[model samples]
Target: MTELKQERAIRTRTRIIRAAAEEFDAHGFAGANVASIVERAGMTLGAMYFHFKSKEALAREVMNSQTEVIEPLLHSEGLQRLVDITLVWSYALRDDPLLRAGVRLAVEQGSFGLKDDSSFRRWERAMTECLEAAKKRGELLDEVEPALVAQFLVGACTGTQLDSQLSSGRSDLTERVVRMWRYLLPGIARRGAIAAIDLDPGRGRGA
Candidate 1:
């Protein structure tokens, strides 16, 4: 396609994804209607299908887009990044239904795919790489298994989102999320019941 055509296609695709996000966020994945999504996008059902094969595809698009929001928190921000990430996540759970929906979809992703896509795979790699970097920087225990720790961290975030949903009306939930981090993150990261880490990394994005 020509550059202009590619740009138009990209714009159309974004509109459809946005519409799908709103529908799915307001209504759970099972409840989201493709017709409604297309209408909201001001595109025909044909146009929607031309962009996305199914509602699941649209949800996947939203999930993929979320990496832009999360990758920074998961990588490169160091220990200080998680605090800000958690604070923002809690606020998102309270205010942005779309983010909560995205979280829900991510939690459910393992059950849906026959094979995890490259994007899904990257989440683990990103976490592993970051933890390895922290270890090299003397911020984490050298003995800690980076991959295991990464998955555990992801599970912790998922649990926090669940807490946010269960408490639906609470505002101070952010603090609770922060406190829960200690349990999952452990101020002293250890490896194989030995080599406990020291020092507070001063939580910011990644705990």
Candidate 2:
């Protein structure tokens, strides 16, 4: 009986989170309505409050859920791995409501008085690790700094994705990300490495 209760509880929480993501994605944090979220989840207000105490808590969970969409990129390393991450994220942003909500909330976090920047920092750390590996493998230019480039890459991706979102609802995000990499690689990659790196937006689909 206890096990069954726990499973049902988990399911209820998951449903509420999914519904919250949908609402938050469609409406910014300030605009999202808890009543509507409960309606979308097919749950009562008391049921949702049992899992998340407040709207801010729900928003934080939605933001954190963005990491759930990323699969482990075990087959590649260095520069290729870095590119794969961005391309995969572009596709994820288009397909996953949770990720889209998280990203939107992240950009508008300031409006809600949320100070968390962990998501952006996490991306920077991942990119920095990949760039460091690339530098060790002689794939990067001598002057390229892994940490600095990682920060720049994250900013570039943020801008490109926002532009894509506003222009076409991210229908062309992958192509835009490819263009972003094309513009960035020449400045950071080694002379011989630029031609060797695959810039195909579809490359991440298999990764």
TM-scores for all candidates: the values are 0.74, 0.83
Candidate achieving the largest lDDT = 2
Candidate 2 Cα deviation (angstroms), residue 41: 3.6
How do the residues 29-72 of candidate 2 rate in per-residue lDDT, one tens digit apiece? 99999999999999899999999999999998888777556646
Q: Per-prediction RMSD in angstroms? A: 5.1, 2.8
- List, in order, the clash count of every candidate structure: 11, 0
lDDT of every model, 2 decimals:
0.63, 0.87
User: Model 2 — TM-score against the truth?
Assistant: 0.83
With a 3 Å backbone cut-off (N, CA, C), the pairs that clash in candidate 2 are: none
| lDDT (Cα, 0-100) at 172 in candidate 2 | 94
Q: How accurate is candidate 2 locally (lDDT)?
A: 0.87
TM-score of 1: 0.74
